[model samples]
Target: MKLKRCFDLVAGLIGLCLLAPLMLLIACWVKFDSPGPALFVQQRVGRHGVPFAIFKFRTMAHDGTAGNVPRMWPAPCITRAGHWLRRTKLDELPQLANVVLGQMSLVGPRPELARYVACYPPAVREKVLSVAPGITDWGSIKYRDEGSLLAAAADPERTYIEDILPVKLAFYQRYVDQRSFWMDLRIIASTVSTLWR
Candidate 1:
């Protein structure tokens, strides 16, 4: 995976450089819109079930546990600017730093909170945790409207645990079984197209 790591380093550095202005702008907007730090940090399950602080631009109000639950306001805790950032996935830009730091890959299973990871069956957990978690993966593209989907659920957490998470886990298992450098490139390309279109 030397080449994969190199690609991550190079692409992450380039992406960070290119997105600097936008990141800064978003940071400032988050600060102005809310009463908390612009960046949100949370413990996520990484490779081998190791926990790490994943970074993202804060898209909610200063409430400490706004994102801890499955469903919040459709636009509840979000600020005016936060809405745009979340919609465009710009809030995820800081994860390039995570990639550069080797905590994540460009394409792999999206890291989950420790609470959710605790629910993963041992074998499936090991399979998904065998690789570094990613910022984007097949599950991500397929569930790009996850917030909206959750908003429509009678019980968001239940629906996620029973329905959504299982499907995502299947995708993660498949990705782990079939991953390659070329596959990563294709996933990234597909993500870009999905985001832009």
Candidate 2:
């Protein structure tokens, strides 16, 4: 909607301005913490199933690979500072830029990696990809400690595909079906409160 778009633009701009110093500090910390670029760009499935690069402050070591890899949560690939960034969700700050660029929305379904997107059935993909991908969503708030959850699994990827992803997809489809400006605001407020708590 027009109001939602305006809200995204205004809030995103304000967030960027207010978080500028923090973002800079994070960039410097990431650089010193690891021998790789401060920012990480990964291809994600966005609106209409389009592929776009999602940006975040690098929260893993340079050699890290996407998705579940064997038994570990790939924890070893995360640098010390990266752990803090990921834990505090500061790594997601860069996505405000993505929202500003119209590559994403303030709230909707979280973007999926191309590999995961490939597993989405055609009908489900059509429903989920109907709107712009978001930085946070119901699934995100509910599964805030997803890394730990995955770590507990005997086969993380299989558990994700069979269980976690289906639940997330249900929430995603619900959001798509009933999304409104006020709903977005509520989601944002809920996210902030959840994070604070």
Best by lDDT: 1
**What are the TM-scores, per candidate, against the unseen true structure?**
0.95, 0.94
Clashing pairs in 2: none
lDDT for each residue of candidate 1 in 1-197, tens digit (9 for 90 to 100)? 89989999999999999989988988998898879999988778899988988889888777777556433344577777777887788889999999999999999999998888888899999999999999999999999888878878898878888999999999999999999999999899999999999
Writing each residue's lDDT as its tens digit, candidate 2 over 155-190 gives 888888898999999999999999998899889999
lDDT for every model? 0.87, 0.86
Predicted structure 1, TM vs. truth? 0.95
Clashing pairs in 1: none
Best by TM-score: 1
- The list of candidate 1 runs beyond 4 A from truth reads 66-75
Q: For model 1, what is the error of residue 145's alpha carbon versus the real structure, in angstroms, after optimal superposition?
A: 0.2
Off by over 4 Å in 2: 64-72
